[model samples]
Target: MSQFDRQSFSLTGKVALITGGASGLGQNYAVALSLYGADVFVVSRTQKGWAETRQRVEENGQRIGFLEQDITAPDCAAAIVQHVIDHFGHLDILVNNAGMQLRNDVLDYQDADWRRVIDLNLNALYYLSHEAAMVMAAQGHGKIINIGSMQSYRAGKNIFPYTASKHAVWGLTKAYADALAPDNIQVNGIAPGYISTDMTRSLQEDPVRGPEIKAHIPSGDWGVPEQLMGPVVFLASQAADYVTGVMLPVDGGYLLR
Candidate 1:
């Protein structure tokens, strides 16, 4: 390994597109990348949290932009990438962080529900990645980060489609990495553990399920959104230039149990 330069972690002059930036981990991701010196473009279903996210990014003295639209719409990826390029003039990082989960037993899960989850979580990501990779290829280099989950490895009680989609995310990461490597674009994933987010708050509050889940984590606790900051900024920077096609778990050793 070559000597590590602290500057390798800087994202100065780069532009990043982060989906689902209206709230949760995506919001933090937008801010974190900007703090490292990257201009950011955020996309979400609504403008609910864009003002706050934009405020945070600008506070770091970085430029920020947002697009309010449902990512599940047809050709949305192409439109989003075009908007970013037209506004920013270039793109360097694509963070496929827009995801949704539906919790229900496999037997009770409806076809519509399954399709909805798959469309937003898996299909939309692939579409955006394909478009982003094209732009990145033209730029001669880029980084793509997919947000996976603990369910990417093991099955969850409910959320069958979510589990399936996340597992497929790992496959997508590898496939894209291989095909885009020659274009100088690196594709990877971050599999976060049971993070404390609005989606998981209910499960964490359940008396029985909550304790059982916590006991399984070797870290003896759940992770917060901020914990993902380092991993994302690392993958987005030069430090991970040689790394690709890997689904890195940010789980608190929950997979061990």
Candidate 2:
């Protein structure tokens, strides 16, 4: 028998909850966990476009479920967490991947816009985490994976709110990790860099900025949603029980520049 203990990375009996999982990185994360043997439940603002996620998970022989809710709405945290428990029997992992980037120059940035980004990216994420932590604490083990951004480290122009929220995400990872250590609850984050998603399609199509962004990354190309699969699975599995408070980058070495 192999001594690698590959089972440590398997989530065969786990149940994971992902936010904004109907599309983008969240969608891929949900699918990744399912493929790795975890039943997944997704929460999104809409029910549209969920067919692919459902089909993919079922095809992989894993169960999949979802809920339509705005994460920022009052009392949503407890409701979603309860929904996961009701459907999956228990929640082993929670992925806070629902976020938005409303870009505008400093002088042109609206107060409303700033609040909008923070509500979904930071405030909502924290509340959901709070609820999830309680369940995990009671169970004596769990994982919370927050999705941060390159802005978590280097603040780029035109996305001030997004940058600030991401920085706070890293801090929350450390804070929650420290507090939840006694309960065996691991809280961590993944910071993606220059991923090629619909949101970034415009940037990729830009003649000047496209090449400029690629030059800054050591990997020499934009990353994809699938690139984050392994890192997320590792963090959510038994393999990372001893690991917490880290923001692992799925970036193509974008921070090296």
The C-alpha lDDT values of all candidates are: 0.93, 0.92
- Residue-wise lDDT of candidate 2 within 122-176, one digit each (tens)? 9999999999999999999999999999999987789999999999999999999
**Clashing residue pairs, backbone N/CA/C < 3 A, model 2:** none
> Worst 10-residue stretch by lDDT in candidate 1?
1-10
Clashes of 1: 0
TM-score of candidate 2 versus the correct structure, residues matched by position: 0.97
> What local lDDT does model 1 show for residue 199?
80
Q: What TM-score, over all chains together, does every model reach?
A: 0.97, 0.97
The segments of candidate 1 whose C-alpha lies over 4 angstroms from its true place after superposition are: 1-3
What is the C-alpha local distance difference test score of candidate 1? 0.93
